[model samples]
Target chain A: MATIQHPYLLFLGDAPDQLAAKTANGVKVWRPEWCIGQFRLPGCKADLGLPDVSIEEAAAQGAKTVILGVANRGGFIPESWIVELVKALGLGMDIASGLHTKITAIPSLKDAAERNGRKLFDVRHPSRDYPVASGKPRPGKRLLTVGTDVSVGKMFTTLAIEKEMRARGLNADFRATGQTGIFIAGEGASIDAVIADFISGCVETLAPANSEDHWDLIEGQGSLYNVSYSGVTLGLIHGAQADALVMCHEIGRPHMRGLPDYPVPEIPTAMDTILHMAKMVNEDVKFVGVSLNTSNVSADEAAAFKAKTAEQTGLPVVDPLKDGVAPIVDRLLAG
Target chain B: MATIQHPYLLFLGDAPDQLAAKTANGVKVWRPEWCIGQFRLPGCKADLGLPDVSIEEAAAQGAKTVILGVANRGGFIPESWIVELVKALGLGMDIASGLHTKITAIPSLKDAAERNGRKLFDVRHPSRDYPVASGKPRPGKRLLTVGTDVSVGKMFTTLAIEKEMRARGLNADFRATGQTGIFIAGEGASIDAVIADFISGCVETLAPANSEDHWDLIEGQGSLYNVSYSGVTLGLIHGAQADALVMCHEIGRPHMRGLPDYPVPEIPTAMDTILHMAKMVNEDVKFVGVSLNTSNVSADEAAAFKAKTAEQTGLPVVDPLKDGVAPIVDRLLAG
Candidate 1:
């Protein structure tokens, strides 16, 4: 993994809407101290509520990296964005991007970084090799947020838990495993880009041995029932050796993502399958709670659903955004 | 995948023993008509029992490619071997290798191949991009050989089944998913070498829609209980959309491969877990038979073990090498 330097100058390059700059919003919300200010191109529709800073002003303010925080269609780095990136590199700042198109692959950005002696970080692609996972139990504790399907708020749930743990002065760190999470963390591998043989190994490396008192809140991917991505999910489960797992689910998903014929697994079935696989590496693995994405439901519906789920599973349930992860964190601490 | 031209000259370059040239032995055993002759340098300790021919003689004998068929220490193509590879390229023959060190990375062989307008295939690396698996059922009858552990004869069992099915005038093709299997089949991707997200997708492409009666005997990889590689195994299961599955297990395994503390999963437990995961994609998936590697046991022990296993699982059980997979094929075709 690359040591992406901060304070970051987030670049919202002509984003079509606020949703296009969600990555920027995540960074601002999670690591506000590391953010210097936002830099926007002409016709940009997103704002980070920070003062607009130019390349020169950001450099003067000691920004060490210019982050490409907005996603456009196709995840491409537009030709116009390259000019701003090149200028940032020339002004003694590294560049970090989570786009499908690598900033380092642009010749102008590449040459400028080389001449200026700065780095270019493509957070989506791993920057180092990983060994085959040994599946040995390492020190410290881990809690993984697995899901019923993709895009079910696993990352958000994980980050919320990390925040709650920190508020209580618990020793915990959020371990990122995806592109946006990688950018937010400033340094972590995107596990999906790794070779199939090394998926678990990459996760093992991402959350290595630490103090026995500490917790690594590992962000999860895919799902045990998702035919398209269950491999990634299983690898993460094995490598995490998670002592506790938090199941994430959306209230109204019709089917597994991208596979219309496959229905989302029932919660109990999903829990049984995931726990069975996780126990191969950690025999003591247990489910601490459930996190729901109840955005589609009204407040009354969300509360009713959460209560019913809690009663059914005998575990605390909450919408991480609406209710926070306090109930889940309380269960984790109790254990 | 690379269309590796055959009529191959097998290069057994200074291998220490016959086991080192097992890949060459496999190709000769499975695709004898495609092998021209064996090529050995001085000090070679292994022989494929074919006529020893020089590059010029092999090319004259209609060899389209020179296959590096021995595993040396570190899987590196030795400096001495490159000279012969370049010579073969000049003689209108392409080069194919399954070494950890890629032949195309060697400047001399790469330059030679480019100048001669020939191809250099690194079979251990995927040659093309793959889409994520859709998990939709395609038109084909597929049989997948899953395993109890890594190196438990999944590939051999699959090949044996293909041979038996072909001999019976049944429509079947062996779908390779590893380096040795790739060379035997002439064209297929090494599934473990693929990007994590594309593991199932690569398998989907390798064994695509065919005539409804045709069978693609897709070779499997690591075990579902093997913590290090269950991800690859799960991905393969989902992508196979297999109508029939053959479980391959080695007799008398004390523990899971590479993990001292993890015991090998019992056959019934393994079957239940694998079938549960497989059902996520193909609800009708069934275990047609079990293939055992009985080489470690005496003849009496092998027979008793096979009979016991058959009774335990209610499926045909056979040592793919000794028993010839006839019973398993009968079971498969009967359905």
Candidate 2:
């Protein structure tokens, strides 16, 4: 994986709403010091609260990369956005994007980058070869966030824990595995984009041997019970070799994401299956906490669900956004 | 997946030993009627016991494809063999190979095939897009052969069961997922070569819905216990959604294949884990038999091991090559 340079100029190209600029919002919230300014096309309604700067102005302010941070419908690069990207490339700013579209595949963007000797990073597509996983344990303390289904706040949980651990003066870093997280971390592969044979190997590469005292809070994807994505989930679990796992769940998920016929496994069932698989790689693996996405429930219901889940699993339970992850951090540090 | 045409000319290009031709040997043993004749280059030591014919003669005899059946050191296509392959393509025959080297990537061979309007199949590489697995149970009976470790004869066991079921006038077809199995089955994607997110989806495509009584004997890959490849194994299991499963094992003399520190799971442990995961997609999933690769043991030891395994698991036990898989087929039919 290429190490994406930062001091980023975030491009919110014609985003119709703040939600479409969620990727940009994540980067700004997580790495404020690394961001220079926001660049929005005409009719763009989203703002990052940074000064709106033109490409030349942002380049003069020492921005090294232009990040395409908006996710519009269909995840395609509009023809209107090409000229500005070409301009950024000619101005010696490399480009990075978390979009499903590969900006590097566009001829104008590709030519500009090549001509100006700049790197183009399509973070959602892996551009390097990864060796098959060796399955040898490396020296690092790692915590992974696994979920019962997709979009269950695994990323939010890990990021929250990283923040809490850092604020407490502990040695910790968030290792991203998805597009939004990649922009926040500034370096990591999209695990799902890798070839099937190399999923575990890619994870091994993402979180390699670090200082034994350091905690690498690796982001997770998919779920063991999700038939559509369980393979990716299992690969992530095995490759993570996590010493600590935090099960993430949504309080009122109707079914496994996208498969109406499949229901999400109960918290205990999900934890048991995850622990059973994670133990294959790390015998010392244990669940330190449960993180709930309570967006679908009332505050009273959320509190009740948290209390009941804590009793059922004998672990710390918290909503990362609502209650903070300090309790999970306490448990992790205690261990 | 492209349906490779039949009446194949087996290309044994200077193989160093009989084992080097093992893939070719598998095709000959399983689908003898589909093979036209063997074509050997000078200094080749491996033979399939078929009449040796030149490319022209094989084409004249109605060969539609030339199959590369040798596993040379490092799996690279030798420059010396390209001319012959090009010649065969010019003679209006498609080419297929399981080598790590893709024949279609070679300019001379690729151009010849293009000029002649013939196809080139690199069976180990997937050439199309696959949707994420839906996880919805489709109609038709499916049996999946899972194993305790890699290279423990999952493919052979499935082939044997398919053969037995067909001989009894049962509706059964062998669905291949690996390179060698693709050659035997004539068409199927290499599951390991798919994008990580698509492993299960590829399997679903390989064995789509069939008649209610028909059986798709899907070949399995990797092992849920093998640390290096468990992700592939889990993906295969969930994608299979099999109604019946046959556990394949090799007794004695082993750690997990290629991982010295890991031991293969015992029969009961292996079956339990597989059954648990398979049930995520198929609630009625079951173990119908155990297929032992008893090549490591003497006849008496093999018999003792088979008897003990059958007693322990309460499933029919057989060596697909040695005991003819009759008992396992009997159990499958009875179910």
Candidate 3:
């Protein structure tokens, strides 16, 4: 099997008018790059898990894809994000996600995933996980879930997937995590306290599946990689012991707004975000795929962008919508 | 003061590109009736709030001028923002806010308060009463403070103000809000949540002075009213709540790069931001100014942008570094 690109993309935004047109003579113009920019998700406080925490710690914990979710005011989510993910995954890839949303429907998401033979383990919600050393009985595969609860958008997406899977004569179990968080930006004693509480809280509701590995990792977020606000690089690499990676991006217009004053936004175009996440998580890896968020944008736009985006990033755009998401798992198996 | 004709203007950036050139295009011009579609800002989510909850809430509560706080990564705080605010205040005009940030030191922040015949309040990181009803035995005048730990550029900008003010002989106390927040959506439950916490937890620590009633407003933030995300109306009637208002903006070459798809590689322009904030904040009371964030862009390009941005917005170009931030604040105060 050929290699698959890592999945995971972070979409950022400046705004609509800013995204739509710029004044050449005090008039506006529609920019083509707006598509790529929209996919570059900024770090969200709600999703403050990225950019605020350490990448190494997250990668260490078997967390490869770190979601940079897009939470904008207007109802705007693009299909390009999932398309970007699928193309990056190569022909067949299996992966989890850095991005989760109840905004998009689940049936649609599943169809999108299956179209490509890719498998998306739709643990769309975030739940708490107990440390294996707690000496308590553990939950199984459920321990690797990302969110404590599927967001309003993610929850909707999961339910739709279940209904559609059943209608299509497919067997599936849609899962949701029941953990909540009180975010604390600290390390050493403080982080331990926060992490212990966070994990314990998750366990109270959902037992860490016996699948919870013996060893785990903690990741940092934000530009201050060593500081709090961890982005989940180490947990995926160290804990998941990833053979490859993929970052999920919403893939839309806002991702391209560059803040000159801030240096972090300077490095990655939406395309670069996918490559960088893969690099940050694994010291050695050749390619990766991305999950394009295709909730609001048109399919033509998504496909056109997928091709352009993939070509630019040197990774083929994987249509998570067309290809089943599990193929990414195959990459893990191949690795 | 005779009311200024076309007292209001709107700045819009549909996308980013050679903005200076766009504003400079030689063609039949059409002036916008209320809002503008030109100019942009040099700031991002870092400046407003990120990672921290209180700061995000503060942005929603304190925006006395317009939703400048809500522009997020789209634009800079237009120099006109301060300019108009100062002019209006000194001249005794009505005002309000759409975002969450400090005032007074900027001048327009003092809502009709006078100290020895001059505006008593300076743009100190002043705390205002957040309208949150807590479950505690309440003292009407008890102090409530909300801290904003901003991002790299923002923390630096905040620190710069401290340094500049102190260097120039101002005695001020600035406490770190610990960390900043990245994404604040609207002035709804999310924003209210953090501010409510501040009202509950920080009352004891604030130790309000008996004479604190001298001040009457909070600051500006993003979630309260941004064009896309939060939907704070950009129209003057629906914008800021200041007696008068001033907006500050950075004008540059990244013109059509207003929207997301295009990443002009130039730092996000600040033109559309200033105008948008200005329009949202007020139409009549004050003059607008420009603080081109020329720090990163080439001097040739930056210098080349001045006339175009000013002419486009119909606001005076004020250099924030040279003219001082006070004049703009004074505009918002009806002295």
TM-score per model (chain B): 0.98, 0.98, 0.30
Per-candidate TM-score against the hidden true structure:
0.98, 0.98, 0.25
All models, RMSD in angstroms: 1.3, 1.3, 24.8
User: What TM-score describes the B chain of model 1?
Assistant: 0.98
lDDT, residue B68, model 1: 82
Model 3 lDDT, residue B298, Cα:
65
lDDT of 3 at A334: 45
Q: Output the worst ten-in-a-row residue range by lDDT, candidate 1 chain A.
A: A69-78
TM-score of chain A of 2: 0.97
Instruction: Identify the runs in model 1 with alpha carbons over 4 angstroms from their true place.
Output: A73-76
List the candidate 2 regions with Cα displacement exceeding 4 Å: A72-75
Error of 1 at A159 (Å): 0.7
What is the C-alpha lDDT profile of model 3 across A1-335, one tens digit per residue? 11112322223322233322111101001111111111332432232112322333333333323222223344444554455444433334343332234422445546656786665532233322333212222333221211111121222222233334445554433332211111100001111112211322222232223343221111211111111111121222222222233433444434212211222222125224323322322334433343345655788887886777566655434445555344433332243
Model 3: how far residue B8 lies from native, Å:
48
Per-residue lDDT value at A239 in model 2: 85
Worst 10 residues of 2 chain B by lDDT: B72-81
Docking class of 2: medium
- Per-residue CA lDDT of model 3 for B129-240, tens digit only, reads 3321111222222100111110112222223333444555644322222111110111111121122112212222222222422221212222111111111111111212
Clashes of 3: 304
Q: lDDT by residue for model 1 over A278-312, one digit each (tens)? A: 88888898999999999888888888888888888
